[model samples]
Target chain A: MTKVIAGASMSLDGFIAGPDETGFEHLFRWLGAGDVEVPTANPGHTLRMSAVDAEYLRDQWDNTGAIVVGRRLFDLTGGWGGAHPIGRPVVVVTHEAPTGWEDTPFTFVTDGVTSAIERAKALAGDRWVGVNGGTMARQCLEAGLLDTIGVDLVPVVFGKGVPLFGELANAPVLLGAPEVVVGSGVTHLRYDVLR
Target chain B: MTKVIAGASMSLDGFIAGPDETGFEHLFRWLGAGDVEVPTANPGHTLRMSAVDAEYLRDQWDNTGAIVVGRRLFDLTGGWGGAHPIGRPVVVVTHEAPTGWEDTPFTFVTDGVTSAIERAKALAGDRWVGVNGGTMARQCLEAGLLDTIGVDLVPVVFGKGVPLFGELANAPVLLGAPEVVVGSGVTHLRYDVLR
Candidate 1:
């Protein structure tokens, strides 16, 4: 069975993005400092993720067969230059798909987050479906679609920005005991959703 | 030398307190689960903090010679019933000292955070001074008086409450690599403040 997992590098203040939303680079700086190659929207250079951080990042990608992301993230990164960074099938949850990307490799689900996850699960087959972007992950969590949550807590704190878990209409979700891994520049915490 | 160290148990959302400003119990629940005795504002039942959590809590108290807290926290807890919880001297920072408490064990410093810390350092002798409460810790961090910061990151998240670090007049303070200890219910992260 395909399991849905959500992962992101967040600041100590729980902000996945800075005020301008262009600060993921700072929040995920640890990934670049490592020795494993990480695919990014940027084409100029390749970032390295090493040691425990490398293992964690590689596991997240290797286990993931598909991804679900938000429309804003897609738009901000220019639809990953028409190709998802992970080279996996991506189901983007958006109210409206951007024009001219109809033929793109990414699948934009306009119905809702559940619909997007459904498409992702179908694409994932027996593998895991990973969800990114704060809003999409929150929606998956609220809908009880996420099986696991991986948070790479960075040391820095953004005074203000997009919070990871904002006002969710659903009740507080209980999480199982977390797997804690202290990396070079980030602490990786993985928790199973107790549904 | 008496170092000024700030410590607090904060939620994943960086909230030290809940909406009603009385949620430290939930954040610091692991302390009660451990085997060490924690002196709380309430003198009812004794809470034990043992095992790794107990060691951590005991070390914090053993190394602390004095404490610095905000007036609000002091007032809310009725000045720790005229005696500091750790049986050490406490410097309470506020605009004015509360009436009729001038003869209490806790010293109310109206000058400023630096003044309060100075008094705490004198009382601390060669031991470290701890700063508690959100406002006082922030002030110490902003004033470059905090030498270290220990945060026990709780798994729970409060939707809204007092944030650990809100707006600060100074630039972002850089923290050295943290010493991470994963406990039963909380992850203790201790970082050296790079001044």
Candidate 2:
């Protein structure tokens, strides 16, 4: 089974980016360095992560088979910026076929959310397929395509910007209690997908 | 000249809290145990603490000079919770003085933003006077009461909640490029207050 993981770090005030939405400086700050451990056992700021926990994250990253992202995130990263950060297969979800870049090698799926997930699953042999992007993540979640969601909460409030799950077109999707870790006021949480 | 800063975090989906104004679990997660390592270079987070950051934050709970909050936040947090978090002076920017909690020790002065800033500044002394509540933080920014804003972002989108700032008031409060660190996909950045 391919596990679709959606993850992002937001500011304390509920903004992924400022009004301009130009750079990710604020987002990076809240997350600190991924090295900081997440304290899942307790609640509040005292949450801390140990060395063994860090290894678990590192392993997840290494094992992620394929990546699925929306046009928004794909455009923001400049089509993965020449060199794809994640070496595995990358599937970009866009209504229109993107132009300007043919140098890199990745699968660009234009057939909406359902098609993208199917393509990603096929591309992801044994490893899990990771879902990126706000809309695509929500779509996969609503469609019951995702298997897990990893959330890293950064600390800053843009006051307003794009949101994760807007009014669900369908009935609400319920995510279970997440495993939490606290460090530098940034909370790291992960939820296993239901169904 | 005292430099004021505002530190806030939000979800990429542009929501500070969940719908209906009821906060999500992520809200509690972002706060952590309140045991944060206040950046030495950026003392604003810990209100200018000396030790390894944690001590300064711990000390802030007791030694805070004064407290500043917005009208909405004052009503929400104040309405339910009788006593304010810190025992120091509290100045709220509202047309009316709240007579609700005579039991709790809080000074509800309704003079104006400028007067409140002056009064809070004088009392704050070496201790940092914390500004809270989204609306209040904005007013303080407009009134020039804030010295530094310590932002902490979380990774959940409420889609709808009280906005941190909006077109009602837009001011040019400059921010230094934040220092960045990453953990669990959450990036933490610290910006110097440049007024």
> What TM-score, computed on C-alpha atoms, does each candidate reach?
0.91, 0.61
- Which ten residues in a row are the worst by lDDT in model 1 chain A? A167-176
Lowest-lDDT window of 10 residues in candidate 2 chain B?
Answer: B40-49
Q: Give the interface RMSD of each candidate.
A: 2.1, 7.2
Model 1 CA deviation exceeding 4 Å by range:
A36-45, A102-104, B22-25, B34-45
Q: How high a TM-score does candidate 2 get? A: 0.61
Evaluated against the true structure, the overall lDDT of model 2 is: 0.57
lDDT of 1 by residue, B1-195 (tens): 789988889877678877776567678678777655766544764667657886777677899999999988888888777777677888899998777876666888899999999999999999999999878888888888988888998877565678887765663455677898888778899888776
Off by over 4 Å in 2: A7-21, A24-61, A71-85, A94-105, A108-111, A147-159, A164-195, B1-16, B24-60, B77-82, B98-104, B108-111, B142-144, B148-156, B165-195
Candidate 2 interface RMSD, angstroms, 1 decimal = 7.2
> For every candidate structure, what is the RMSD over all alpha carbons to the true structure, in angstroms?
2.4, 10.5
Query: Model 2, chain B: what is the TM-score?
Result: 0.67
TM-score of chain B of each: 0.91, 0.67
**Candidate 2 Cα deviation (angstroms), residue B83:** 3.3
**Residue A77 shift from truth in candidate 1, angstroms:** 0.6
